[model samples]
Target: MENKRTEISDLGEFGLIDRISQNFTSVNNETELGIGDDAAVLNSLGSRIIVTSDMLLEGVHFDLSFTPLQHLGYKAVAVNVSDVAAMNAIPKQITVNLGLSNRFSVEAVDEFYKGVKAACDNYKVDLIGGDTTSSMSGLVISVTAIGMVGQDKITKRSGAKEKDVICVTGDLGAAFIGLQILEREKQVFMANPDMQPQLDKYDYIVQRQLKPEARMGVVHELAELDIVPSSMIDISDGLASELLHLSRQSGMGMKIYEDKLPIDKQTYDTAVELGIDPTTAALNGGEDYELLFTVSMDDMEKLKKHADIHFIGYVQSSDKGNIMATKGGNEVEVTAQGWSHFKKP
Candidate 1:
């Protein structure tokens, strides 16, 4: 008998998601959404519920050699919280599932839990439940978060209207630049095990990559300012990819200013040092974990003084297509070069 085989690359990341998602039908009317979006929105008896999950694997998501167990645990929670914030909801509970290999000691597991507990306390979320199992290959961490938001307060990627001003929290590219530096240092150490890592100068970007903070404060501040973004999505998959999500979901196009795109000084310098275009990194670097949202033009004043958020563009008619106006004053079509774990082969 001949074996059937197909390459994961042929489907691509989005294709795989779509193919898998097609089989599952939303049985519950309360499940306003299921897959594809920053988070899933469900209608509860009272307030609406926001649910999101993320899974991190040892070799794929992080390298145990450099990434601390504590930070990994904390980051797992932070990424989940960031999704809840994207829905303009308050995270309440999270259930974690972990798989461990014998290489890890009991103390190492305890350290991971400490970080998880710290994140729960900081986010004001309950560590309601979890499961642990033994794995033969590598460690695996999966977390699912539940949050609540008022019906009117809930935001979705589809709510964006034509002409809505697109905004993003904080800068981009730092995390990717940080990853580059870490890889370089890792290689240097490999060639000569005695070599000390040159990490002091790359502290900012390194932290940005390893200990990324979810912009939960932005959600609180937006509420305080009385400005609810018409649509919201988190920047887990590069700014350019996120913009395309907003545009496709909202049935609109956009024109973002290249000069208006935000990048930290450290990120810009590191990108230059690595012979990478800073602007390209800002557009395509994943793992940023910041919020990318859209708001009414009139509400712009409410966020005008926000130090971290930058207004880069506005939604346009869908026919014009999503574009970025370059610093050179030319428009270029936005493409998604987001991370695809399926590309491993």
Candidate 2:
């Protein structure tokens, strides 16, 4: 009873971030970007600099179970860039910090770097700096990205207005389902070493979990069409959570249609196979990494024919309430049920 120790799992991930960053204070005025949005924003002469950081852990956020190191490295960077993209900025530089245990070899570390290099090339962001340290447990990778955009062009989660159309890019729920599949496969392998995984049917959902794209492609399309979203957030959380964030910031409620929600055929089929409600997965599943945004009705013409983006609903008066009219013709209030890492097991 004299000596005591506590487990980190008790604090959860976001709690750890809050505890660590609480003691930190803003110093330099030029340190415009810090720890809030997808990235931080710095003030510059003609442009506002953007910054953001993320850490991927071994057992919690990611499982080395069925995931390859290279994809893990690439995904870590893409997740950060998705934040930068959420700000409507272009990524220019990044710093990577790593915590490795002796279990990983020099060759394994090289493979991780190879993935990082691929992401840098894809996003046109440079690998500027970082630190490599030892960890007693498994691998940990933290990335900080810096980008820039004009002050007038900045998009936060705070600009939606009533009547602004709610839009979502790509589909939803694939990544979460993919995680389920991977976990299932891993258990099967552990149960019988000779049992080969029948993964051919789940390849798409599996890749969605392992190799999520940042949707910079959609950003480019929005730019080419000359439309900026009134408010925006990437869907790292569930669609419901991100929608509520935009609503609170804009002082409005939202009205989205369940019939209009986009779920990939593969995702739907697999969700049913796993005995999960496809609608629930689409609503509350996290880490799809697509952009959830609001655009003025006038900008609608620009994206109407576009393939990936869907006009799911519109911002409404908070007095009217945030509700979804299901495909079955019933209305229900939207709620935030994102992956609560603090979730009781």
Candidate 3:
């Protein structure tokens, strides 16, 4: 049976908003009011609130040919939440603004919201309000997440001191390698429609690309362990690029051991099969959404036993420069070749 398509024009904006608003219920007490109002209200929560927004364009940020609407919706919320977690904040609310073209139907929007609701549930956040409007060409998603952190507990990119232990949560490069596989399979499908996608074997890497989780678990664990990262950022634009962000903001140099970099077995194997240097992918492949942070040496023992946390390096004075010690005993300046959305073709 074919899915029924209800045109946005037929329902109009108010009707569409009504349909969407009915599907969501506020989960956070901080969200005093959600949807159907001129503006949403949030309680003070007795802490500093952090806000972050991200925009995703159709062809630029994603390819719908291989991307599922459900995953895309989840990712949009997760990425924003990752930013809040990087600041050592607890996410409370989000407002999503979507630009849809006529190509999308009510069913498509419903699928997208289902993913959104799932993310809200997972992150313990409330959907306060959002706007939906027509687009000129393709789909556009903009999400703004609001979170709270105590003044003393908030982490910034500029807090690293010399010799602070650099730590990263989880493995890397799987998402980028997954993208390579998806692109390859997309090409194959375009060439021959009858060929089924060879994706079952690449499930881990593929899912990493599709549905990434924010390191809220790490944040919560850090709080439980009574440890606060000196500085932190999510690995959204690859490890190397984010490391440079810390370097520049904190006015410190970094020394990371190449051997200490985290790469999953699946990511490594796939990178090699795709002829990409696994280390390079770990360094420059973006969208891992793992937390990269620094902690005082005194706090190292607290995290040493944690299986997913890897101590990759230490911070140094700015005069020493940003460098990575390779496995072959050579040191090279870390370069930023991660995602550059504005880079010209």
lDDT of 3 by residue, 1-345 (tens): 036988878888798888888878887778899887888999866989999999989999999999989899999999999999999999999999999998998888888888898999999988888889899999999999999989999999999999999999999998999999999999999999999999998999999998999999999999999999999999999999999999999999999999999999999999999999999999999999999999999999899899999999999999999999999999999999987887987
Best model number under TM-score: 3
Clashing residue pairs in candidate 1 are: none
> For residue 202, what is the lDDT in candidate 3?
97
For 172-252, candidate 1 gives per-residue lDDT tens digits of: 999989999999999999999999999998999999888888888999999888888999999988999999998888899
Give per-candidate clash totals.
0, 6, 0
Report lDDT (Cα) of residue 286, candidate 2. 92
Q: How does candidate 3 score on lDDT? A: 0.94
Winner on TM-score between 1 and 3 is 3
In the range 63-122, model 2's lDDT, one tens digit per residue, is 887988889988999999999999998777677788877676545665677777778778
Which regions of candidate 1 deviate over 4 angstroms? 1-45
* TM per candidate: 0.86, 0.87, 0.98
Residue 126 in model 2: shift from native, Å? 0.4
- Which pairs clash (backbone N, Cα, C closer than 3 Å) in model 3? none
Model 2, which residues run further than 4 Å from truth?
Answer: 1-45
